[model samples]
Target: MTETKKTTEKTLRRFTLSWQLALGMASGFFVIFIIFAFVLSQILKQYYGRLPETLYQWLGITILLGGLFVFGFAFMLTRYILRPVKSIKTTIEAFEDDPMTNVRADRANVNDEFYDLVNILNRMIDRLQSLIGAQQQFVSDVSHELRTPVTIVKGHMDLLNRWGKDEPEVLEDSIKSSLAEMQRMETLINEMLNLTRAEQIPIENVQEVTEVGGLVHRVFDNFKLIHPDFIFTLDDDLTQDANVKVRQDHMEQILIILADNAVKYSLDRKEIHFALSQTTNRVEIGIQDFGEGLSSEDAARVFDRFYRVDKARSRAKGGNGLGLSIAQRLVKAYGGEITLESALGSGSVFTIRLPLQRENKNDQKLSN
Candidate 1:
């Protein structure tokens, strides 16, 4: 019991980080002051030895002056050293109170490691805000997109309930339309789930270096088979193997999304082009179609979730407008970028750029 009591008292004596720092600095200064006073006392005693009666008085004066100097200097030093820490704490408290506040720590004038910490914290706050915005947008999109099919199903059911069941043709039409709407709702839910997963794919799953040329050609073959009516062609400018760090599924999904979009829009031309190019720093895959192109305003938002440049055309092609969005998400998650270019009368091209690795020594030697 006595040992436990002593341990508890010791723990209670522990100071907060700021207090600990102040106490440590004060203790160090006090130690030095004690040593200096001791040395001065000896010197004073030696010089005033003849006046031995006043020896005690001189020593006391020396100790008092040294104690005063040490205490005052230590107090100011501790406060000055911890000023940045206090500022960071206050900024954090303000941010917690109002997340949208644009409060930042004092980093511009100060040059210290704490500046790095503050910069990181500010970046985290920005990312948090972006995530919250994305989440709200996602919820709004789901609500808006699902409303059409839901309304259609409900209206048809109401019609059937109101004497439409007695008519054979109306009964059959309502049943068929309700079933179709239900299927579309199911697909929408699944695609939304896929979009969410695309945003959160495990990075470890995409750490492997994949040769992109072969993968592109494989997709070309698959598309050729899938859309035999359309001419599928591959144009390559690969002096060497173009490689990117990505998973096979990620590569395939992105290619299929672009190729599918090409096929959908190229109803008149019945041809799709796949262009693959490689450079020292990056690899590019372009999916081009000679179809009715989009205006600049629509092209700018091609990858936006549930955005359709031509709503009727997209619906006819059975596109919920999530395919390109998912593709863009996957590409970005793998440290890559996807872009679209189009003139209103001409065709559109979707290009993907992924960082490339330098040629290895063995590949260089083999080429030589």
Candidate 2:
């Protein structure tokens, strides 16, 4: 019984807007007719005798015609006003049914109000499509990356299961191989988590300030101690230390990623240069390495997640290819940008540009 009641209510509520508007107009006309008849009767009885039957009939016919015209006009006007709304509804429904659909709301001949609404809807569709595409690509890449390590580990286990465990050397080699692959997988998963965190910096920590020069110096010193064979030089052109609105740890991580990349790619000339400078309103830090530089195409896409110029070499060097991507995300989160410059023979220089924090109201010009 409850189901039947719900079905009946749904059927009744399924009336379209046009019909509902027409019914409302008809009801209004009925009220007006009753009021007019009451007034006419009172006036006629007060001043004259009863009217003729033919005259009453003619009056009724005139009112009926007027009501029909008004009802039709109201229905047509309602449809015209709701045209854009219907178009938007239809497009959204289509998109919801099939996310891959490229349909967008039509904006032609719409009023200013609906034009803005349609524009916003179109922009939202574009953003959603972009995010969907990126998500699909990321999933595909992750699956591809995991397949090799997973296969290697599984193959070794199968070997050990098939009587290889009886041989001491074979069992030991298989165990080592499986452990290495598992370690690789663990590293890849951790880097993925770090990339996710980089994309979403906490809003409360956005105002955290760090001294740019001090952090750079610390990174430089640490790397020098770690890689003593390589030549390291620091060119600090900033007369006074500059401050930026970013967490110290985040800034240090960015520096470390770039510095580590510089150290990794150096082949013959094991030299790294750290340069820090400030402009009127900005601070710039650059890491330069005399290394195996990249081609134009490689430099363009070097910061992309899981992108490496030489995939085999990067894997051998224990790089999961998420470092630069994480650095880029962190820099942009704090309203800064990182850029790269390199050629086939010449080495690369990765530079980070950030807005310098103002010390006080009187501070205007920054020392070059």
Candidate 3:
């Protein structure tokens, strides 16, 4: 009963501007009628059939007085009705001047609708703040990561040129180091460019119906060719079903990034495992490596841009640290999720979960 009464009160409070204006006009007209009735009746009784002219004067005065009163009352009602709207306008102007300002209305004295709107605006501002913070952090990380590699390449080249002929072996190693650093820098720049392009383009630009198994096999084949020393294996439990709706190129890039990371970080360089599985509603692809796995803290930040658990080793192995970050972004762009599981001294597994297209009921029945 209390809830019902509260709901009815809420309904009554939600009056539109037009409805309020109409009500104010009606109330003003009712007041005019009351004044006219009282004044004309008194004037008619006072004259008592003696003089209609005297009654005419009093009737005119009554009409004039009623008009004045009604106008004044309506003016006051309009001002009262527009007060909250004007306050909201002023608050918005202040927020525009400084987006970080926590400007909020006094909810206890305002309409519930206005109060709710202010709450939603505050929430939106909070989200914008978080996004801006993340962008700033990304810029800082990129600058630091890129600067170090460029500095190393320059230093090593300078040394090789100064004493290259006198110390041939030293000069040769310096050149190799410089070349490796340059390649690392190139990879980092390319990964960052790909991430930027992925964000700039529309989703429809890259959407396609791709064969998941075939794409994985192609990436694996490329990886094997590039890293001839490492043994790469593909387990094809998932590729049998061919109805996964995803961008073919994007999926291949994601797979390559994961496989490359696994191969680079594996301890024994024995084998890297790639497997695909399909469920009723989803498909999951996992890349597992038997490496010196990440600690809990490192695992938590593994996908962060330019973050590496073993920074020295990452530089030595020519990793730019942007591969996982790019892969994560690409997977998320397709309404998919990427997850990592790892433990110290154990292996790491990265999983990508993508939604599977449902087969039409008619087609399924026909096939059955």
Arranged by lDDT with the best first, the candidates are 2, 1, 3
Q: Cα lDDT for residue 103, model 2? A: 89
Error of 3 at 228 (Å): 4.0
Residues 1-368, model 2: lDDT tens digits: 99699667645553466689767876787678768876876787678678778868877887788678767877777677777887798679778977778889999989898999999998888767766765676677679889999999999999999967588888999999999889999988787767766765654457778999989999999999999999999999998879999988889999999999999999889999999999998999999998989999999999999998998999999898889999998899788899999988679999999999877645554532
- Per-residue lDDT tens digits for candidate 1, residues 1-368, read 99699657644543255457666777788788778877876887688765465666876776778667766677676667666776677678678877777787777655476788878887777767666666776788889999999999999999999868689889899999999888988888888877877886656566578899999999999988888899888899988888788887878989998998888887578889999997679999999999988899999898988999889878877889999999999999888899999988688999999998566899899999
lDDT of 1 at 184: 84
lDDT-wise, the better of 1 and 3 is 1
Instruction: Provide the lDDT at 80 for model 1.
Output: 70
User: Among all windows of ten consecutive residues in candidate 3, which has the lowest summed lDDT?
Assistant: 198-207
TM-score: the better of candidates 1 and 3: 1
Q: What C-alpha lDDT do the candidate models reach, one value each?
A: 0.82, 0.86, 0.76
Candidate 3 lDDT (Cα, whole model)? 0.76
- All candidates: CA RMSD in angstroms? 7.4, 6.4, 9.8
Runs with alpha carbons beyond 4 Å of true place in candidate 3? 1-95, 99-135, 153-183, 196-207, 239-245, 359-368
Q: Give the per-residue Cα lDDT of candidate 3 at 175.
A: 86
Q: Which parts of model 1 are misplaced by more than 4 Å?
A: 1-28, 35-58, 108-120, 164-171, 193-206, 359-368
